[model samples]
Target: MSDSSALTQKLQQQVLELPPESLPDLEKFIEFLRFKFQPRKPKATAKPALDATHAVRLGGLLQGYDFSPELLKEARREMWRKFYVEAE
Candidate 1:
C-alpha cells in the first residue's frame, strides 16, 4: 500500500489503543482533520427574484402547478402581457 496510507493506518491503530482519557483530545483533532479535508458541496445559484413590474419568477410561480409544459408557455406569455402591456 501507499506510504501515507500505511502511516495513517498505524496512527489509527495507535489512537484506538490509547486510554479513554486521551480520547477527547483525539476526537477533537479528528473533527479538525475532517473540517480540513472534507469536500464542500457546491452552492446552488439563487433564482433571480421577481420584480413583478419587470418579470415574474415563472419557475417559482409555476412550481405549484402540475408539469404542464404547454401551460408553462401560456402562463409566461400571460405574465408578459400583464407586466408589459400598456394600459392604453
Candidate 2:
C-alpha cells in the first residue's frame, strides 16, 4: 500500500479506538486542521476611480490671491529688514 493509504488506515484505526466522548473534540480538531490547511483565495484590492463629482479643485482656496514676483520680493525684504548688515 502507498504511504498515504497506510497513514489513512492508521488514522482510521486510531479514531475507531477513541472513546465516544472524545469524538466531538476530535471533530473540532479535524475542522481546525481543515481550516488551517485549506487554500486561501486572493483578496480583491482594486481601488475605485475618482470621478468629477469627487475630484479635488486645485488652487481652490487661493482663487483671488496675487502671486506677483515684485510683491513676493517686497514681502521677503520686509520680513528680513532687521537682519540686513550695514556696509562699512
Candidate 3:
C-alpha cells in the first residue's frame, strides 16, 4: 500500500493500543489540534474617527501659519505655564 496509508494504519493501531488512562490526554491533544487548525475570526480595530479627522483638518489649517522655533517655544511655555508651575 501507499506510505501514507501504512503510516495512518500504524497510527490508528497505536491509538487503539493506548491504555485507558492515557485516553484523556489523547482526547485533549486532539482537541488542541482541532482548535489550532480552525479558522479564526478577524478582530475589529477601534479608532477615534473624530479625533483623526480633526487632526488631519488641523494640520491643513496650520499649514500656512509658519512661525520661528523660538516663537513656538515661547508659545508652548506660555500655554503650559500653569501645568509646569503645578509640576514643580
Can you rank all candidates by lDDT, best first? 2, 3, 1
lDDT of 1 by residue, 7-47 (tens): 99999899889999989998999999999999988668966
| lDDT for each residue of candidate 3 in 1-88, tens digit (9 for 90 to 100) | 9999999999999999999999999999999999999998765875545764476444576576769899899989997997889899
TM-score of 1: 0.38
Q: By TM-score, rank the candidates, best first.
A: 2, 3, 1
> How many collisions per candidate?
0, 0, 0
- Candidate 1 — which pairs collide? none
Q: Which parts of model 2 are misplaced by more than 4 Å?
A: 46-88
lDDT of every model, 2 decimals? 0.86, 0.90, 0.87
Per-model TM against the reference: 0.38, 0.50, 0.46
Q: Model 3, stretches more than 4 Å misplaced?
A: 44-88
Best by TM-score: 2
